[model samples]
Target: MDDEYAKLIRRMNPPRVVIDNDASADATVIQVDSVNKPGILLEVVQVLTDMNLTVRKAYISSDGGWFMDVFNVVDQNGNKIRDKEVIDYIQTRLENGANYAPSLQETVDALPTEEHTSIELTGTDRPGLLSEVCAVLAALQCNVVNAEIWTHNTRAAAVVYVTDDSTGYAITDPNRLSTIRELLCNVLKRNNDVRMPKTTVSSPGVTNRGRRLHQIMLADRDYERVERSGMGRVDDKSSRPHVSMVNIERDYTVITMRSKDRPKLLFDIVCTLTDMGYVVFHGMVSSGRTEAHQEFYIRHIDGRPIRSDAERDRLIQCLEAAIERRASEGLELELCTEDRVGLLSDITRVFRENSLCIRRAEISTIGGKAK
Candidate 1:
């Protein structure tokens, strides 16, 4: 019974806990019932609290047939907590001579039904990996409803349930699902010993991007225009997109975009380059009513172009599509370049600070010295 209670606690990641123990002849009950000893129930409460759970109340009933213990735990802020509520119930059963703990599914079902999408991720743990995953999910507009993470003996596992407030886009479309999977795979591949299996589950009633055209159309118009300019010609055959690739022997690259395009759009564009096999060594974005531009100096990871002209062109098309989808109402995007000294130096500073190094450089200027 004592071992069962321990197992139950391990499964529930509660925010707070309060327990009442009913005195029984069982060793487990006796240990908990011995409240007079320090480091017993109080110790358990401390451990739970350290895990960010709060126990507000407890009750013990040793009467015949009514022999049970009850606890009232809430979130840190005193909200009613439910994740560990079942633990107290399980303790009651153990006190009544139940020898086995509940099944994993049964225990999971005992909790409240809040709206959330559960994702199971297993991989090698590294610094900043979790943050990167969360950032991608946040960028996709997924709200984290709950998260459970465990790492033991160098193995890491995470279970996250995400939900949106509108509840309209729960989970739909294979392309978006594939994109997420690909992103996770790429991130894991960067670390040794980290491998993720390809399996995803989407909750019903979620609308995927293919069905959310209206939301996509909210991007800035100027960004859409520049993005269109970046697309490849129809004749291109590469599976990726076509964009200018300059090997930076130096440390960075400077890209100029229209003032109407937001910094966020510029960042997305650079990330798109990465998705297309281009590794950004350094970059920066500046935007104003009169000027909006991003400068990136990057290098090919394998010391060669990752995408052919045709493939690069396709990526450019996708960038245009994404910009058009994210374009804000009434903003005009127009990009033009002016000459400046040490332009490369300034751009490299941004990249260096971000831990990117350039292996080549490409510079283009209009109405200014070409040198």
Candidate 2:
């Protein structure tokens, strides 16, 4: 009997989540048992938010690659979520996992054309410090526009230009700005090995420009997979930075880059090239099973190909750094394709299968096309 019971338990999925309602208490209790991994806390919290569920309290513990977490949650209506279907849906998603992929058209429709916000900081620096800052910004739905970081005398100062991705404008709201400031100040203080922040900061307003992208993929679409060819690849797979260049016999220069996809990735690369005096005549962007491939055909603004080896080397270094920064920042991705039934679910499943995590999403339809 013991052997049979052990076998049965072993055959079950590793992650087992249970949801229960406390009617008198006016809240739902969620218990999760799962394998431990980095960022699991963030993932669970994000799921609750996506469901419009508010967390009243949470207790988390992890040891020996296993974790047990319990969350006291309430629905948007400030009552327990007791619907069986809704509870089952949440359980399925948390147990299996789901992703929200925002289409490209959605980004164009939502982001501002010119206005953007800025964050400035000065403090002692250490390794992995920028990554931490970017992580916080990503969590807060802020996207970087321009970042300049410098260090001197063991003190680091950074000025980051950003835009609320949802609004594409400078964060002018006082409460939101205060929250960002407090969060960043706390991060910097911690990095400097200082005391914790004591003040309770205000919460900010978030305007919804479009639909939330975290709806779980169900039905046939969830089973579909994105073709590997749809995403491009580098011919020289062993390339360290996964970026290569070729001069087209004084006609044009071809720069091929392969990296994990992120929001505004193409924008960043093209912006860098344009700033460097190159004019793109044509380009192609595609997703691979695990990476994104981008090809840009261009020449100098003066219609001349990059001729000098030194200039070519400099360009290579710049592109490499840009790719590295995006990867570390953990940004979003844009998907554009002809719409069909279950399209969103299919696309999001592709990203999930490839190990891409979606932090935020927006979906919109324009001109009879879904973005």
Candidate 3:
């Protein structure tokens, strides 16, 4: 009854969305006003990220039963949004109350799926692991549909969408899935790994794939500092996000973060905090050419400020890991080739043979083409 009442209230007060190109000379300004609700902030951010726009700055305020956010966003090239169709699309999408959850799949670096099985894997990071994993899938007759992989702190995690090569549909045979999981787990395991490798198979959903990766790594505790630094080990402190927290009056924890700016950065930070059971009452975000600065006034879901140094340290570590998980470390590469069985396997094999390390990668299929 409470949930239905909230929905009714939201419907009664339609959101007011403004896409103003004149508000900021440097970037387009988007403002949304609506009845406050849980997860609405993330939904809005997800919409912009789905369109591939860079949110350079944002102001979030959801208090006193109302929600309002202002965003300064730019195109991929860091210019104001000038396309009329795009502007109209943004306004319509936000104002009409279309579901933003579906957009999350695209933001997570996967195209809308027709039918595919999501393969999740995590283990110690290694050079040839990807090649071995791909080879295992190809051997099992699973065709790569779309996927995203991230490696950090000497730990690797991947969400791969695969279909039956022969049927071009989700691999649903229980035996095949079990075999796929077993083989992939074997490929992920290392002799020196402290933790066991894991593999899970499921039909993909609207949940953001990138956030799913973050959750997987967090569960694997990738934030723990790797004492012995080597290849793919995130010992490079330079790339880690700088986080600071201070208790303010009225019992609020003010968390400030500064880091190199990237796409969907705000969303990543907010998503992590929320998942950690922290609620942001207010936030201010600003990003320059290369660096982003964010300040969030928050409290625990239990209505308390962060209590101890240990808790603070853990929070900082988790936030840093979330940021670094998606950091673009390797040379920017784009692969646009014909989609076929074993194509990904062959490509990964060449990279592994060349001793190339893949920090992060995304695979997609569109109109019979793969990228």
Top-lDDT structure, candidate number: 3
Can you write out model 3's per-residue Cα lDDT over 270-315, one digit (the tens) per residue?
7788778887888999999799999998888888999999999999
Residue 334 accuracy (lDDT) in model 3:
93
Write model 2 residue lDDT over 1-371, tens digit each, in one string: 96676546544636789898862386798988876544444455455655667555555555345667777777767788878867877787677643432322232233322365646565444444555566677767775544344432233455455667678567778888888888887777754333232222222112111111001111112112223231232223253357788999878888888776544445445445655677665455555435677776778867788888988877786666444332332465665555443444455556565655443344443444555
Per-residue lDDT of 132-241 in model 1, one digit per residue for the tens?
55666665656554444432222234545555434623445567667766776666553333233322445523321111222222111112222122111232233222
The C-alpha stretches of model 1 lying farther than 4 A from their native spots are 1-114, 191-199, 202-371
State each model's CA lDDT, in order: 0.38, 0.54, 0.84
Number of clashing residue pairs in every model?
Answer: 42, 4, 0
Best by TM-score: 3
Q: Name the better of 1 and 2 by TM-score.
A: 2
- Which runs in model 3 stand beyond 4 Å of their true positions? 96-114, 232-234
TM-score of each: 0.29, 0.33, 0.94
